[model samples]
Target: MRAVTVRPGAKDSVEVGEVPDPVPADGDLLVDALAVGVCGTDKEIARGEYGTAPPGGERLVLGHESLGRVRQAPPGSGFSAGDLVAGVVRRPDPEPCGACARGEFDMCRNGRYTERGIKELDGYGSEAWRVEAEYAVKLEPHLDRVGVLMEPTTVVAKAWEQVERVGARSWFEPQRVLVTGAGPIGLLATLLGIQRGLEVHVLDRVTEGPKPGLVRDLGATYHAKDIEQVISAVCPDIVIEATGANEPVLASLTGTAPYGVVCLTGVSPSGRRATVDAGAVNREIVLQNDAVVGSVNANLRHYRQAADALAEADPAWLERVITRRVPLERAAEAFREQPDDVKVVIEF
Candidate 1:
């Protein structure tokens, strides 16, 4: 079988190579890879910025957003031989801190959680991979073309979960949501917002492209102008900052909506300093009782919720999120994102 291999910290180490077929271990379920989504994390790993191979192994398989079909399942595993599934990426640490002890490895307090393709395990960017039954969640048959998106959606699922959790800190009924950026995460944030019956608005830098149309088609207002302009018009009760870019992050943090919730879902680069009014930001949060939280990775509950979200969404709309797809052989080129690309996937 062929797998995409990379030396974790070595630049230009990404390549297509041959590897042995998966030998299912006891209690392991075999999954035949269909397609894997390529996001910024994968690109960063390729550039030697971040990634870890299995202990003692030099090369790591390079994909985390995976969609696959079950090829073999142990008896009574709750999975069949043909079910479409996506694997949970993170695993609990050995110490199994308080959070991981409760099956919330996504919040491992000791910082020892292992993530497939990003931490210490091989990913599903190959012809096949073996996953524990508990880590694999079955998906609706309708998500065939867009199932690769399940991972990204799970991210926002957790973000929304936290937002609602904080909103419950007081009497809360959010009506308007401002999502910064119209990338995959931001769009999915908008989708979930609409599903929650909120008036959603999205802001992005691109003035023309499928993005404006995509947001508008969902009946959400799209803005490409200054962030403050849109923010003032909406006075959103909830803000989801999906672009880790400095300006948007600062704007969301400093928003003045009383009792509002802000979810920072983007991973911003360090050292990219921005001049922010820290006192004013603190004043807004303190005076208005606003809550700002950051969320990443998904636990089993979030994965299940993301599954339900995708199952209920229109298939046409879900498919539009994946703007490009290429064969496994051309996986390297898939990383070369075009100006208009939304989500890019590599078909195995």
Candidate 2:
């Protein structure tokens, strides 16, 4: 079987080649890969800026945003042979932290958590893969084509969950939300915002693209202007900052309504220095009781939440989010950036 493999820290080393077929362990489900979504993390790993292979191995399977069909399931596992599923990414460290002990490995405190495709595990980028039954979340049958999006959706689901948890600290009833980025994470954040009955506004740099229309079609406003201008005018009660760029992240720090909750989901590159008015940013947050929290990776609960959200979403809209699909043989093409691309997936 062929799988996407990459040598960590070796730039441009990602390639697809024959690998031994997966062998499931006890309580593991053998799945036939259907597709895998390529995102910034995957690109970063491909560029050698991030990622790690299984211990003592040089090549790592390069996928975490996975979608597949179960080919074999253990008896009494509550999963069938044909179920559509997406495997959970993060696994608890062997020396379980308090969080991991409670099934909250996403919040692992010791920084020793292993993640499929990103850490010390072989991911689901192969022709076939095996996952523990408890770590797989079954998807709605109708999501066959768009279920590759489940992982990214889980990200935003966790972000929103973080925002609400932070908001619960006080009298919080947010009416509007500002999502800073029109990429998959941002758009999906917008979708979840709309589902919550909040007015959603998305800001992205591209003035001409499907992004603007995608936002508007979801009954949200789209802005391509300056981040400050959009944030000031919107005065959103909650800001979901999905752009790791300096400007929008800085603006979100001080540009929300009183008692606002800002959830930062994007990962910015280190060593990119930027000037910031630290005093003012601190003063704004302190005076208004604002909260800023960074969220990434999803746990089992979030995966279930994402599954339900995707099931309720419009199939056509979800299909549009996947702007490009490359076959496994041409998997390298999926890494090349396209000007108007949203979410690119490699079909198995």
Provide the TM-score for each candidate, comma-separated: 0.99, 0.99
Residue-level lDDT of model 2, residues 1-348, one tens digit each, is 999999999999989998999988999999999999999999999999999899999999989999999999999999999999999999999999999999999999999999999999988999999999999999999999999999999999999999999999877899999999999999999999999999999999998979999999999999999998999999999999998989999999999999999999989988989998899999999999999999999999999999999999999999999999999999999999999999999999
Q: Which candidate is the best by lDDT?
A: 2
Off by over 4 Å in 2: none
Error of 2 at 131 (Å): 0.4
Per-residue lDDT tens digits for candidate 1, residues 1-348, read 999889999987889999789898887889999999999999999989999999999999988999999999999999999999999999999989999999988899999999999999999898999999999999998787899999999999999999999998778888999999999999999999999999999999998878998899888999998887788888889999999998888888766478888999999988998777789989988988888888999999999999999998888988888889989998888888799899999998
Backbone N/Cα/C clashes per model: 0, 0
* Model 2: pairs clashing at backbone N, Cα or C within 3 Å: none
